[model samples]
Target chain A: MGKMELVDSDGAKLSSALNRIARDIDAVFDVLLPVPDDTRAPLVEAMRYSAMDGGKRVRPLLVVATAEMLGVSRDPALRVGCAVEAIHVYSLIHDDLPCMDDDELRRGKATLHKAYDEATAVLAGDSLHALAFEILTDDETTPDPFTQAELVRTLAAASGMAGMAGGQMMDMAAESADYDLHTITRLQQLKTGALLAASVEMGAILAKIPREGRSHLRAYARDIGLAFQIADDLLDAEGDEEKAGKALRKDDEQGKQTFVTLMGVEGARNQARALVDHAVGHLGQYGEDAAVLRALARYIVERDR
Target chain B: MGKMELVDSDGAKLSSALNRIARDIDAVFDVLLPVPDDTRAPLVEAMRYSAMDGGKRVRPLLVVATAEMLGVSRDPALRVGCAVEAIHVYSLIHDDLPCMDDDELRRGKATLHKAYDEATAVLAGDSLHALAFEILTDDETTPDPFTQAELVRTLAAASGMAGMAGGQMMDMAAESADYDLHTITRLQQLKTGALLAASVEMGAILAKIPREGRSHLRAYARDIGLAFQIADDLLDAEGDEEKAGKALRKDDEQGKQTFVTLMGVEGARNQARALVDHAVGHLGQYGEDAAVLRALARYIVERDR
Candidate 1:
């Protein structure tokens, strides 16, 4: 096949995979969160609303794609995908609160706090946080208790203070502090990179690939994580707000130092491209089986959203 | 010993145990949440401030006492106790948010949101929620992966939508809804009772007691769980704010239906006493070795705060 044809084919495959996983995740969340006929119904409804039919499902797609490439079955992979998505959704719900990012729109709809009251939004986010662990430890997710425990540890470490929340703290400080490129990189690594890396790590974990064997995959995830953030910054700087589906340019508005601010737009774009190239190189060992992942890495930079 | 002497001795033992576990949990949290010399420092400080030196350490005490009674070592029990306490602390932080109960005082000090900013408070609670699972799944907590997974499942179930958060949702609705006694009972069961029951259940889990063997312990937990909430309601109705160290009678002010509202003060007191007696009776299978558990049940009703 010609190079252009190869790019087109890979792009088609990635798009199809993304669409499929998004639907799968929505189905899983539907089954996971059922509204009860009681006072708690609104809470469950809010949780379902914020969790389903939202986002690019990038985290879940990464998990499922990487797990499948490693010869793992799709059932466990989808369940684990849902677990990571739950964490992602919960964080977004909390982040969009009036006290945090205060964004009114998410995934082309009202944020959780706007859709429901703040109290219900907080409880719903918390419930989803708990649901992540619940799904991981459930026997139906994986009968192997060791795998279950390992999954929980991976996710908890990535989501907790030293990881996503810690990164967020740095981001919050970015509004006031004079952050250099090094600080911004570290901030992004924790806030966004950690969970992205965890998605790949969890895939290897489900395959029982052994920690030492996952260096290449970790490098791939790290590169793509950075590239993804840069692209996000670029989108916030120049991409269409309607396509992004949330308020863009808020980073600039907040005077928060980001990749685009630290590095010029051209410099940041080149850096993201370099990272994507490096990320794809790490997957050369997996050959064609890694096509979707490589495509995902490219998609991280290429997509408007 | 005479009945009076036995009662006095048990009370003394329970008090000492409570004090000791409180210190132990604080020390564990101190180690677990050291303030890093970075932007995340404030987040860690907020977490440490709320998690340590507060709240009677009742959950941790229950985990340790019950585990020790079942012949488990103290080290693992303390770790598990810390895990449960982390969940309890996180819930309290979230419940005290301005959008929630809006309480300024917790554990005789300012609530987390009052101490830190609202965003930091939200992140700290989320971090602590993640930390609970992290502690449970750590190899140091339990060498057995099965046990670790089980612990995560128990804590997650108790703290999530079907548990404490679900109950909190009901509690929030109580301000506007006309709830009957049955609804209130169910609400309390999910809110306060779930974690309380999980504390005892976790001890049984750590001891590797089979599900069938845990029947009496489950019954004991169920009884004590209800007794604990009823006692709390009574405290809210008439207990001294100085003694409680927080605002009291807010339930009456909110016009919410509580155990005190559904059952009058004398009726609630009798119900709590009956629950304590029933909880203690269920521990007969453990004989004198269950003395601490029995004391804890009585203390649930007897505690002023």
Candidate 2:
């Protein structure tokens, strides 16, 4: 509750937790990718490069921290976390393709299509998508087949229609047509929030937490998910490209509607802060066990990139 | 079997069964596609056009027929069949992309990317891929979650790095390099046979048949898979495009080593005939329950297109 405690937990501890998860997930991907690669060298390399390339491991950390709080085993949690990252990265790769957003930079490096060919980029994304399901259904993901099926169903629903892909279609349409705040909010919910909400809920799914028990966590995730996008829009409007590791000012250049454009920078920032406060409040039941997630909700809105 | 029975079964009966399955799967695709016609019209339309436009739906028929013979309930079997068809159609849509085979025609119609734009085709394929896994893991796919999980695992393994995608990488590389019979055969096995084998195996899985009991069926699928590719090569060499629907003589034009190129036309035909016989012989244990499959193997080799 005190200012000093907030500074210590929110700043140093959050960064430390993020770093630890980054290392663990990178190791998971490293060991999991087949060695002695034959014909799949380019595809495998593209997958590894896109997935393991140093983006912030926010989703994985959410999976790990929430699962730990719920007393779930670290093994299945880590594998599930990696699967989420694979899907996330695959989405990024496809979103960056020439026929899509066509951005040349990602993670401070050339996008997959820019670095590799379009065909390899497509295959890498496609292969990673399959691998995510493969990992979730593997015996190593969970000994219980029922739990594995649940994860597969959860992720497939999160990433498919009425979810990420559907959100992307809405987004593509947004560039050509006029959209108000509600439509943009719905678009953001589908495009960005679906996976983020799913990521938080995965911790509960791994622990087999009851629906009622996890509702507050879902509330927390939904709040921060919107907050995350507002932060993204703020970054695009005013942040530095070197820090963000991708292009900035794209929304403005493309004449796309964003939180900043809709609400003004100051208003958008205030709203994001309000969302983070509500998100942190939803963790009241978890007490000290949710300290990391509490700090993350705050850190998410406050991060520079 | 009696000679008169073979004559009755081979000609009208096989075609009739194929027609029946083709219609059933088309109906399955029809009801499955969401039709509110909201923001996802383009994506939903693309998915419908590609999945329902037209194909043999051989994979779906394989799933339905084999499961029916195994006494598996029709509901789950039909859903699994649709899932397999979805995966197969997704592969076809992606394969016809400008970056891949760049084909203009499929099933006597313009390929998806040709009919629609490239990005829509990519999303359609990607969405269908996820839909396959989604359908497999859904509660509607089966009452037992374990069986559903097994289907997810099987389909993912058949389509990912060590399977179809890996095979595609090899196939792309083949254009730039010289490959022998063994390499091409391995490519064909992974590219085509893995999915076919998985399709046959799904029936056994749905029936809860043990691995040992399904081994002969797996063997049968493997043999016919190779025979199917050989027959394809012969079609590419000598068949009419109007009948085949897609472009012909592609293997020769691309200078790819195929069964017909490695073995003479007569030699390839003989090998395919032998494989069909072996495949049918493996089903001896199933008796008349597997009559459709036996006729299918022979028909695969005998059909001109």
Candidate 3:
């Protein structure tokens, strides 16, 4: 269920797929990112730092995986994958800015604006967010005008106030010492889970899946999103800063209300386990083809970092 | 044909429309803007300052005018109109920050980041950008999904690096002491013209106009956009800072290339007139239906502020 087990079994294929996608992503990033020639240095550096800092590409991979599950070729999903990563990168870029988390560490290095200047980081984030939609709407691979519209709406909704921004608002609100559990979970769901849900839901929609399946996928994403946040809190509780590539337990100083804050550490772990089980149950519809997804849910909870 | 004549004739109607739409737009803004309570005060205030500024909703007016031209109801375009305004306000908020323009005034009031702090302004801009699309995708008026998708792509392209950001980049790059007319024109197109173009073109799309008509509208918008920028530059050249609510002759001091910098004031006036004439010419196919657009173009070049 852990990264070790998944790595041992499907390590080569996933690695090769990830490597290929990363190259494609980097190439596409080169073209799609708007680095005006004169001011390109800071933007290029910021974009590379945020985008290439290296995550599992889980969202983009979900795009490909979801497409695969729907019996569609992965090519069309490539742009969606790129778009999803762009959103993720943009969120990370803004989240790390001095106005927000004011963090120095992200992906094992200085957060954007810290590595670059504040203005450059801000522009980079803004440009990247715009670029994500631009990538989604490219006339080349995007389905029809209608589907493109849906994609736009879906991603926008997820990234905006009702989704990530809403969560961020809640998170900011919950910064006080007495935030309740419901309020904290609400923040995490909207802030972190919304885009993750959109990442999967976007892939499903692109594959033209039926409504029933789409709903199921949304449910699965919701469960895992909460589970992922809980896992994040758990990691912060015990994770090494070097391995986690960011300051650990920093949320405590910030008085951030997290799952572990709301529920005791053991209770938070139990909740995460329950969410994972719920997510896996939803995957029952996909059968053995859901193996990657199954492994992903496990990885979400069990990863040390 | 120009401002004084149109103002004398349709002043009542325009004022009433403006008043009604303004109220409607205000209500929408109040309802849709971030309400982050005490915890999220920073994000909320930032969004409000950027979005709720009491500016004339010219872009939203365009949406209404174009929709009326096509004999469609304005209800569907209402939310989209607000969405466009959100993007516009967000862009201005971000653009007026110290790193961008260091401006203190917009619509005769302090700019968002200036009124609040830089961080809130940044977050407000970011969230508002996302909010624009969120409004488009929400099932408010139930525009066809295809139409919504096209709107998404259109707005994204208009707002991204190739549009607003690209223009901002050119503006930033033009901080040097020398530049030519063409570069100046290009910069103006990206900076001021791009969103203006989106304003008109997006209105056209929302009305579900034919492709040929859409192209013509874009051409008309392109001309008007240039005219708008030229007129603004001319105003700055001769404008009173108190009336303009922004500095005058600053472009000259910055050594930035502008139409006024390239051509003498008289020449810029001639260019603005020509562009407006060209904008009017493109509406020949629309006949009497384009009267409001023609009026708008005239107003752009002739308004005192």
Give the poorly placed runs of model 3, Cα more than 4 Å off: A1-20, A34-49, B1-17, B34-46, B247-249
TM-score, prediction 2: 0.97
lDDT of 3 by residue, A1-305 (tens): 67566445544455566677777766666665545565344555577668863766778877777777777677678788888898888888777877677889887888887777776777777777888887777776565766776788888888876788767766755656477887777778888898889888888888777557598888889999999999999999878888888888877888776788778899999999999989988987887577667767777898776
Q: On a 0 to 100 scale, what is the lDDT of residue A74 in model 3?
A: 73
Q: Candidate 3: deviation at residue B64, Å?
A: 2.0
Query: How does chain A of every candidate compare to the true chain A by TM-score?
Result: 0.98, 0.97, 0.90
lDDT of 2 by residue, A134-244 (tens): 999889888788788888887888898678898888888877877889988988988889888888898888999876888999999999999999999999998999999
Badly placed stretches (over 4 Å) of model 1 are none
Give each model's clash number: 0, 0, 2
**lDDT value, residue A57 of candidate 2:** 87
Top TM-score hit = 1
* Model 3 agreement with the true structure over B99-193: per-residue lDDT tens digits: 66788888788888778777667767878999888787777844587677777777887887677776776677677626588778877787788
Model 2 segments beyond 4 Å from truth? A1-4
Going through the candidates in order, their DockQ values are 0.94, 0.81, 0.56
**Ranking of all predicted structures according to TM-score, beginning with the best and ending with the worst:** 1, 2, 3
Residues B45-151, candidate 2, lDDT per residue (tens digit)? 99999888588777887888789999987778889999988888888898899888999999999999888888888888888998998899878879798899889
User: Which candidate do you rate higher for lDDT, 2 or 3?
Assistant: 2
lDDT of candidate model 3 versus the reference:
0.78
Which one wins by lDDT: 1 or 3? Answer: 1
RMSD for each of the candidates: 1.0, 1.5, 3.2
